[model samples]
Every structure is written in C-alpha cells, then in structure tokens.
Target: MHPETHLALHHTRATDLRAEAAAHRLAAQARRPYAIRTRLGWTLVEVGLRLASPRPAFAH
Candidate 1:
C-alpha cells in the first residue's frame, strides 16, 4: 500500500476508535448517579447496623 493511503486509513481508524471510547465514557457518566446512590444506600445500611449493635462496657 502507498504511504499516503496507509496514513489516511490509520487516521480514520483512530477517529472511529476515539468516537467509540467517547460513547462508552458518556454511557458510564449517565450511570454515575445510580452508582453513587447504590454506594450511599450501602453506607446508610452500615451506619444503621452500627447504631443497632451493642457496645461492651469497660471495667472500672
């Protein structure tokens, strides 16, 4: 293949790959709120469990 043609092909492939990666990144960003909510729910559950548990008394 000619050098110019190879370079063009490489540029097209790189652009396509970049577009694909950008789409994936946007998808992840869209789901970020759900991920944060899930983490917050778990953290709240942990806090609730800690509050419900009994503590040991120290000897005087």
Candidate 2:
C-alpha cells in the first residue's frame, strides 16, 4: 500500500530478473564455441558441395 514498499518490490524484482538473465547469458556464452563450430561446419559443407558441383560452361 505504501510507495516505499512498492519501490522495494520493484527493485527486488528487477534484481532477480537481472540475475536470471546473467545466468542465461553465462550458459549461452559457455556454449558459444560449440555453436560457432556447428555454423562453421555447416558452412564448410555448403562450400564443399558448391565446389563439387559442375559449373555451367560459358559459350563464346
């Protein structure tokens, strides 16, 4: 009912949300290398396919 109480509640909730976000960010950071590797692997596979495929010959 009091303004101070409402402010405190908001502050506490904000702190909790920030902490939760930090935890998620850390987890994502930990897995970042794996994500990058997966992307790179897919890119390499795509490049390989492109290289292996026959190209259209240009007529003069």
Candidate 3:
C-alpha cells in the first residue's frame, strides 16, 4: 500500500514538472517575435536621438 501511494505521488510530480516546462516553452515562443520588434524600436529611438543631438565642433 505504501509503495503504491509513493508511485502515485511520483507520477503527479512528474506531470506537474512537464506542464511547467511546456508553459515556459510556450511563453518563450510568444516572446521571440516581440523581442525582435522591441529591439528594432529601441534602435530607431536611439538613432533618432543621435540625429537630433548637435555635433561638437573640431578645432584646426
């Protein structure tokens, strides 16, 4: 009886772990496309800021 109970508990824990891993993988997949867009947005903002800022004069 005790061994059966242990087996049941181990199965439950293994299922939970697998579910957690699947959730993480799904979340990462969802984020991957947005990640590239986010990086591109930030790059555009940085370029705009650099273009707007004045350049320093060089001495002869």
Q: Count the backbone clashes (under 3 Å) in each candidate.
A: 0, 0, 0
CA lDDT of each prediction against the hidden true structure? 0.97, 0.97, 0.97
Top TM-score prediction, candidate number: 2
Q: Model 2 lDDT vs. the true structure?
A: 0.97
Q: What order do you get sorting by TM-score, best first?
A: 2, 1, 3
Q: Which portions of model 2 show Cα errors greater than 4 Å?
A: none
Error of 1 at 7 (Å): 0.7
Residue-wise C-alpha lDDT for candidate 2, range 1-25, written one tens digit per residue: 8999999999999999999999999
lDDT (tens digit, per residue) of candidate 3 on 1-60: 699999999999999999999999999998898898999999999999999999999999
Clashing pairs in 2: none
Give the Å shift of residue 48 in candidate 1: 3.9
Candidate 1 lDDT, 1-60, residue by residue in tens? 999999999999999999999999999998898998999999999999999999989999
